[model samples]
Target: MADEYRPEFIRRKFTITESLDEVLKQMADRYYQGNVSLCLRASIESYREILEGEGYMATRRIERQLENLVDEQRTLLMEITSVRSGLQESHRESADGQQLTEPSMTNEMVRIIELLKTTGDGLEFGDLVEQLDLGMHKVQPALGRLVDRGVVTRTGEDGERFTLAGFSQHYLRSGP
Candidate 1:
Protein backbone atom coordinates (compact mmCIF):
# COMPACT_ATOMS: atom_id res chain seq x y z
CA MET A 1 0.00 0.00 0.00
CA ALA A 2 1.16 3.52 -0.81
CA ASP A 3 0.65 6.47 1.44
CA GLU A 4 -1.52 8.77 -0.73
CA TYR A 5 -3.34 11.27 1.47
CA ARG A 6 -0.85 13.84 2.71
CA PRO A 7 -0.92 17.56 2.91
CA GLU A 8 2.13 19.23 1.43
CA PHE A 9 3.08 22.72 2.51
CA ILE A 10 4.98 25.63 1.14
CA ARG A 11 8.21 26.63 2.83
CA ARG A 12 9.55 30.12 2.36
CA LYS A 13 11.88 32.37 4.28
CA PHE A 14 10.14 35.62 5.08
CA THR A 15 11.87 38.58 6.65
CA ILE A 16 9.79 40.38 9.19
CA THR A 17 10.75 43.22 11.50
CA GLU A 18 12.38 42.14 14.74
CA SER A 19 9.41 43.33 16.75
CA LEU A 20 7.06 41.38 14.57
CA ASP A 21 9.20 38.27 14.85
CA GLU A 22 9.13 38.57 18.62
CA VAL A 23 5.37 38.97 18.69
CA LEU A 24 4.97 35.96 16.41
CA LYS A 25 7.03 33.84 18.76
CA GLN A 26 4.94 35.03 21.68
CA MET A 27 1.67 34.24 19.94
CA ALA A 28 2.94 30.79 19.03
CA ASP A 29 3.82 30.14 22.63
CA ARG A 30 0.62 31.49 24.10
CA TYR A 31 -2.03 30.59 21.55
CA TYR A 32 -0.53 27.70 19.63
CA GLN A 33 1.53 26.29 22.50
CA GLY A 34 4.86 26.90 20.73
CA ASN A 35 3.62 25.62 17.35
CA VAL A 36 4.96 28.45 15.21
CA SER A 37 3.95 26.79 11.96
CA LEU A 38 0.35 26.39 13.00
CA CYS A 39 0.24 29.93 14.35
CA LEU A 40 1.50 31.33 11.05
CA ARG A 41 -0.87 29.14 9.05
CA ALA A 42 -3.86 30.24 11.09
CA SER A 43 -2.96 33.91 10.65
CA ILE A 44 -2.42 33.52 6.91
CA GLU A 45 -5.72 31.74 6.47
CA SER A 46 -7.58 34.42 8.36
CA TYR A 47 -6.12 37.24 6.26
CA ARG A 48 -6.23 35.26 3.02
CA GLU A 49 -10.00 35.39 2.85
CA ILE A 50 -10.03 39.17 2.88
CA LEU A 51 -7.22 39.69 0.37
CA GLU A 52 -8.34 36.88 -1.95
CA GLY A 53 -12.08 37.15 -1.66
CA GLU A 54 -14.30 37.36 -4.74
CA GLY A 55 -15.01 40.80 -6.22
CA TYR A 56 -12.32 42.35 -4.05
CA MET A 57 -9.61 44.45 -5.67
CA ALA A 58 -6.58 46.26 -4.34
CA THR A 59 -8.23 49.64 -4.71
CA ARG A 60 -11.34 48.33 -3.01
CA ARG A 61 -9.26 47.06 -0.15
CA ILE A 62 -7.59 50.42 0.33
CA GLU A 63 -10.87 52.28 0.18
CA ARG A 64 -12.45 49.85 2.58
CA GLN A 65 -9.58 50.20 4.99
CA LEU A 66 -9.81 53.96 4.90
CA GLU A 67 -13.56 53.90 5.28
CA ASN A 68 -13.30 51.45 8.11
CA LEU A 69 -10.78 53.65 9.86
CA VAL A 70 -13.05 56.66 9.62
CA ASP A 71 -16.12 54.79 10.78
CA GLU A 72 -14.29 53.24 13.67
CA GLN A 73 -12.92 56.59 14.78
CA ARG A 74 -16.28 58.28 14.54
CA THR A 75 -18.03 55.62 16.51
CA LEU A 76 -15.28 55.56 19.12
CA LEU A 77 -15.33 59.29 19.66
CA MET A 78 -19.10 59.36 19.99
CA GLU A 79 -19.24 56.53 22.46
CA ILE A 80 -16.34 57.84 24.53
CA THR A 81 -17.84 61.28 24.84
CA SER A 82 -21.25 59.99 25.75
CA VAL A 83 -20.03 57.45 28.22
CA ARG A 84 -17.53 59.75 29.90
CA SER A 85 -20.13 62.41 30.50
CA GLY A 86 -22.85 59.98 31.46
CA LEU A 87 -20.61 58.07 33.80
CA GLN A 88 -18.96 61.07 35.46
CA GLU A 89 -22.05 62.18 37.26
CA SER A 90 -23.19 58.68 38.16
CA HIS A 91 -20.06 56.82 39.23
CA ARG A 92 -19.76 58.31 42.71
CA GLU A 93 -23.44 58.77 43.25
CA SER A 94 -24.64 55.24 42.65
CA ALA A 95 -27.42 54.09 44.98
CA ASP A 96 -25.24 51.11 45.90
CA GLY A 97 -21.76 51.46 47.39
CA GLN A 98 -20.14 49.05 44.90
CA GLN A 99 -19.79 51.30 41.84
CA LEU A 100 -18.85 54.27 44.04
CA THR A 101 -15.70 52.45 45.04
CA GLU A 102 -14.75 51.95 41.42
CA PRO A 103 -13.26 54.78 39.41
CA SER A 104 -15.28 55.99 36.48
CA MET A 105 -14.17 55.13 32.96
CA THR A 106 -12.64 58.23 31.43
CA ASN A 107 -12.82 59.34 27.81
CA GLU A 108 -9.53 57.67 27.05
CA MET A 109 -10.46 54.45 28.83
CA VAL A 110 -13.85 54.47 27.17
CA ARG A 111 -12.21 54.93 23.79
CA ILE A 112 -9.77 52.08 24.36
CA ILE A 113 -12.49 49.84 25.74
CA GLU A 114 -14.82 50.48 22.82
CA LEU A 115 -12.05 49.95 20.29
CA LEU A 116 -11.04 46.69 21.94
CA LYS A 117 -14.63 45.55 21.73
CA THR A 118 -14.54 45.78 17.93
CA THR A 119 -11.22 44.03 17.36
CA GLY A 120 -11.12 40.50 15.94
CA ASP A 121 -8.54 39.44 18.49
CA GLY A 122 -6.42 42.09 20.19
CA LEU A 123 -4.27 45.11 19.32
CA GLU A 124 -0.81 46.39 20.08
CA PHE A 125 0.24 49.86 21.20
CA GLY A 126 1.00 50.77 17.60
CA ASP A 127 -2.34 49.46 16.46
CA LEU A 128 -4.08 51.52 19.11
CA VAL A 129 -2.38 54.73 17.93
CA GLU A 130 -3.09 54.03 14.28
CA GLN A 131 -6.73 53.08 14.86
CA LEU A 132 -7.63 55.58 17.56
CA ASP A 133 -6.09 58.72 16.06
CA LEU A 134 -4.53 59.06 19.51
CA GLY A 135 -0.89 59.77 20.09
CA MET A 136 1.31 57.75 22.43
CA HIS A 137 1.08 60.67 24.81
CA LYS A 138 -2.65 60.11 25.08
CA VAL A 139 -2.80 56.32 24.92
CA GLN A 140 -0.13 55.51 27.46
CA PRO A 141 -1.82 56.85 30.54
CA ALA A 142 -5.26 55.63 29.58
CA LEU A 143 -3.98 52.14 28.77
CA GLY A 144 -2.04 52.12 32.01
CA ARG A 145 -5.12 53.10 33.95
CA LEU A 146 -7.24 50.40 32.31
CA VAL A 147 -4.62 47.74 32.88
CA ASP A 148 -4.16 48.91 36.44
CA ARG A 149 -7.88 48.65 37.06
CA GLY A 150 -8.00 45.12 35.62
CA VAL A 151 -10.45 46.14 32.91
CA VAL A 152 -7.87 45.31 30.21
CA THR A 153 -4.69 43.33 29.84
CA ARG A 154 -1.33 43.69 28.05
CA THR A 155 1.15 40.94 27.11
CA GLY A 156 4.30 40.30 25.05
CA GLU A 157 8.00 41.21 25.23
CA ASP A 158 6.96 44.88 25.71
CA GLY A 159 3.29 44.56 26.41
CA GLU A 160 2.65 44.27 22.70
CA ARG A 161 -0.96 43.18 22.80
CA PHE A 162 -4.02 44.55 24.59
CA THR A 163 -7.43 42.96 24.93
CA LEU A 164 -10.48 43.28 27.15
CA ALA A 165 -10.45 41.86 30.69
CA GLY A 166 -11.61 38.31 30.05
CA PHE A 167 -9.54 37.87 26.86
CA SER A 168 -6.13 38.26 28.51
CA GLN A 169 -5.01 34.76 27.53
CA HIS A 170 -6.01 35.18 23.86
CA TYR A 171 -3.30 36.15 21.37
CA LEU A 172 -2.85 36.57 17.59
CA ARG A 173 0.27 38.69 16.94
CA SER A 174 -1.77 41.95 16.93
CA GLY A 175 -0.71 43.95 13.84
CA PRO A 176 -0.68 43.55 10.06
Candidate 2:
Protein backbone atom coordinates (compact mmCIF):
# COMPACT_ATOMS: atom_id res chain seq x y z
CA MET A 1 0.00 0.00 0.00
CA ALA A 2 2.88 2.43 0.72
CA ASP A 3 4.28 1.72 -2.76
CA GLU A 4 0.85 2.44 -4.40
CA TYR A 5 0.14 5.73 -2.57
CA ARG A 6 0.43 8.88 -4.71
CA PRO A 7 0.64 12.58 -3.71
CA GLU A 8 -1.51 13.81 -6.66
CA PHE A 9 -4.49 14.39 -4.34
CA ILE A 10 -2.59 17.18 -2.58
CA ARG A 11 -2.91 19.53 -5.61
CA ARG A 12 -6.71 19.36 -6.20
CA LYS A 13 -8.39 21.51 -3.50
CA PHE A 14 -6.23 24.64 -2.94
CA THR A 15 -6.73 28.22 -4.24
CA ILE A 16 -4.25 29.41 -6.94
CA THR A 17 -2.19 31.48 -4.50
CA GLU A 18 -2.24 28.86 -1.75
CA SER A 19 -1.72 26.10 -4.31
CA LEU A 20 1.46 27.78 -5.66
CA ASP A 21 2.89 28.02 -2.16
CA GLU A 22 2.01 24.42 -1.45
CA VAL A 23 3.57 23.30 -4.72
CA LEU A 24 6.84 24.99 -3.83
CA LYS A 25 6.80 23.33 -0.44
CA GLN A 26 6.07 19.98 -2.04
CA MET A 27 8.95 20.44 -4.52
CA ALA A 28 11.33 21.06 -1.67
CA ASP A 29 10.06 17.96 0.13
CA ARG A 30 10.23 15.88 -3.05
CA TYR A 31 13.78 16.96 -3.77
CA TYR A 32 14.84 15.78 -0.30
CA GLN A 33 12.96 12.49 -0.83
CA GLY A 34 14.23 12.01 -4.45
CA ASN A 35 10.64 11.94 -5.89
CA VAL A 36 11.24 13.73 -9.22
CA SER A 37 7.84 12.91 -10.79
CA LEU A 38 5.90 14.36 -7.85
CA CYS A 39 8.02 17.52 -7.95
CA LEU A 40 7.45 17.97 -11.70
CA ARG A 41 3.65 17.43 -11.43
CA ALA A 42 3.32 19.97 -8.62
CA SER A 43 5.31 22.53 -10.55
CA ILE A 44 3.10 22.09 -13.66
CA GLU A 45 -0.18 22.39 -11.74
CA SER A 46 1.07 25.54 -9.99
CA TYR A 47 1.79 27.16 -13.34
CA ARG A 48 -1.71 26.31 -14.61
CA GLU A 49 -3.36 27.94 -11.58
CA ILE A 50 -1.35 31.11 -11.86
CA LEU A 51 -2.25 31.51 -15.55
CA GLU A 52 -5.97 30.78 -15.01
CA GLY A 53 -6.55 32.82 -11.86
CA GLU A 54 -8.78 35.90 -12.32
CA GLY A 55 -7.06 37.97 -9.56
CA TYR A 56 -3.49 37.53 -10.81
CA MET A 57 -1.95 40.99 -10.43
CA ALA A 58 1.29 39.77 -12.00
CA THR A 59 -0.44 39.38 -15.34
CA ARG A 60 -1.86 42.87 -15.17
CA ARG A 61 1.54 44.28 -14.31
CA ILE A 62 3.05 42.47 -17.26
CA GLU A 63 0.39 43.89 -19.59
CA ARG A 64 0.94 47.43 -18.33
CA GLN A 65 4.67 47.08 -18.84
CA LEU A 66 4.07 45.87 -22.42
CA GLU A 67 1.83 48.86 -23.16
CA ASN A 68 4.45 51.26 -21.89
CA LEU A 69 7.03 49.48 -24.01
CA VAL A 70 4.83 49.86 -27.10
CA ASP A 71 4.41 53.58 -26.48
CA GLU A 72 8.17 54.03 -26.26
CA GLN A 73 8.61 52.04 -29.47
CA ARG A 74 6.15 54.29 -31.32
CA THR A 75 7.89 57.45 -30.16
CA LEU A 76 11.22 56.13 -31.37
CA LEU A 77 9.70 55.25 -34.74
CA MET A 78 8.35 58.78 -35.19
CA GLU A 79 11.71 60.32 -34.38
CA ILE A 80 13.43 58.14 -36.95
CA THR A 81 10.82 59.07 -39.59
CA SER A 82 11.30 62.80 -39.02
CA VAL A 83 15.09 62.52 -39.21
CA ARG A 84 14.86 60.50 -42.41
CA SER A 85 12.60 63.09 -44.04
CA GLY A 86 15.01 65.91 -43.20
CA LEU A 87 17.91 63.98 -44.69
CA GLN A 88 15.98 63.22 -47.86
CA GLU A 89 15.09 66.89 -48.36
CA SER A 90 18.70 67.90 -47.86
CA HIS A 91 19.87 65.28 -50.34
CA ARG A 92 17.34 66.41 -52.94
CA GLU A 93 18.44 70.04 -52.60
CA SER A 94 22.11 69.19 -53.02
CA ALA A 95 21.63 66.75 -55.89
CA ASP A 96 21.92 69.50 -58.55
CA GLY A 97 25.54 70.38 -57.68
CA GLN A 98 25.50 74.03 -56.40
CA GLN A 99 23.51 77.18 -55.76
CA LEU A 100 22.75 79.60 -58.66
CA THR A 101 23.33 82.97 -56.97
CA GLU A 102 26.44 83.96 -58.99
CA PRO A 103 25.79 82.18 -62.29
CA SER A 104 26.30 84.28 -65.43
CA MET A 105 23.04 85.37 -67.05
CA THR A 106 23.91 83.48 -70.22
CA ASN A 107 24.35 80.20 -68.33
CA GLU A 108 21.20 80.96 -66.35
CA MET A 109 19.21 81.44 -69.57
CA VAL A 110 20.27 78.09 -71.06
CA ARG A 111 19.59 76.25 -67.78
CA ILE A 112 16.15 77.88 -67.58
CA ILE A 113 15.13 76.62 -71.01
CA GLU A 114 16.36 73.13 -70.18
CA LEU A 115 14.65 73.25 -66.84
CA LEU A 116 11.31 74.28 -68.34
CA LYS A 117 11.57 71.85 -71.26
CA THR A 118 12.37 68.97 -68.93
CA THR A 119 9.82 69.81 -66.24
CA GLY A 120 7.17 71.45 -68.44
CA ASP A 121 6.00 72.98 -65.22
CA GLY A 122 8.66 75.46 -64.02
CA LEU A 123 11.10 74.24 -61.41
CA GLU A 124 12.39 75.72 -58.16
CA PHE A 125 16.06 75.13 -57.34
CA GLY A 126 15.11 72.10 -55.32
CA ASP A 127 12.79 70.88 -58.03
CA LEU A 128 15.58 71.33 -60.55
CA VAL A 129 17.69 68.74 -58.69
CA GLU A 130 14.76 66.35 -58.31
CA GLN A 131 13.68 66.62 -61.94
CA LEU A 132 16.98 67.02 -63.77
CA ASP A 133 19.14 64.79 -61.53
CA LEU A 134 21.85 67.48 -61.80
CA GLY A 135 23.86 68.72 -58.83
CA MET A 136 23.24 72.24 -57.39
CA HIS A 137 26.84 73.19 -58.26
CA LYS A 138 26.16 72.62 -61.98
CA VAL A 139 22.74 74.26 -61.87
CA GLN A 140 23.97 77.88 -61.40
CA PRO A 141 26.49 77.83 -64.20
CA ALA A 142 23.93 76.30 -66.54
CA LEU A 143 21.36 78.88 -65.49
CA GLY A 144 23.93 81.62 -66.23
CA ARG A 145 24.46 80.22 -69.71
CA LEU A 146 20.74 80.36 -70.40
CA VAL A 147 20.42 83.89 -68.95
CA ASP A 148 23.23 85.20 -71.17
CA ARG A 149 21.70 83.51 -74.21
CA GLY A 150 18.52 85.41 -73.42
CA VAL A 151 16.75 82.07 -73.37
CA VAL A 152 15.56 82.25 -69.77
CA THR A 153 14.41 84.95 -67.37
CA ARG A 154 14.38 85.14 -63.58
CA THR A 155 11.39 86.78 -61.92
CA GLY A 156 12.03 86.70 -58.21
CA GLU A 157 14.68 87.49 -55.62
CA ASP A 158 17.09 84.59 -54.96
CA GLY A 159 15.93 83.38 -58.40
CA GLU A 160 13.34 81.33 -56.67
CA ARG A 161 11.22 81.44 -59.82
CA PHE A 162 12.09 81.51 -63.52
CA THR A 163 10.49 81.56 -66.93
CA LEU A 164 11.53 80.56 -70.42
CA ALA A 165 12.58 83.94 -71.92
CA GLY A 166 11.83 85.48 -75.29
CA PHE A 167 13.56 82.64 -77.13
CA SER A 168 11.76 79.57 -75.79
CA GLN A 169 11.03 78.43 -79.34
CA HIS A 170 14.65 78.60 -80.46
CA TYR A 171 15.98 76.70 -77.43
CA LEU A 172 13.10 74.21 -77.56
CA ARG A 173 14.24 73.01 -80.97
CA SER A 174 18.00 73.59 -80.75
CA GLY A 175 18.79 71.90 -77.40
CA PRO A 176 20.74 73.85 -74.76
Give the candidate number with the greatest lDDT.
1
Each model's lDDT comes to 0.76, 0.60
Candidate 2 lDDT, 1-176, residue by residue in tens: 46986555554654457777676567767673756456667667768878788437777888999999999999999999999997566433222322323333344344545457544335676776666666778877776666664545675667776565543434444554
lDDT of 1 by residue, 78-161 (tens): 999999997676544323222322446678788887788667567998899889998899999989988887767876567789
- CA RMSD, predictions in order: 27.3, 15.6
> Backbone clashes per model, in order?
0, 29
> Where is model 1 more than 4 Å wrong at Cα?
1-103, 156-158, 167-176
Q: By TM-score, who's the top model here?
A: 1
CA lDDT for candidate 2: 0.60
Error of 2 at 165 (Å): 32
Query: lDDT, candidate 2, residue 102?
Result: 30
Candidate 2 clashes: the total is 29
TM match of model 2 to true structure: 0.31
lDDT of 2 at 145: 64
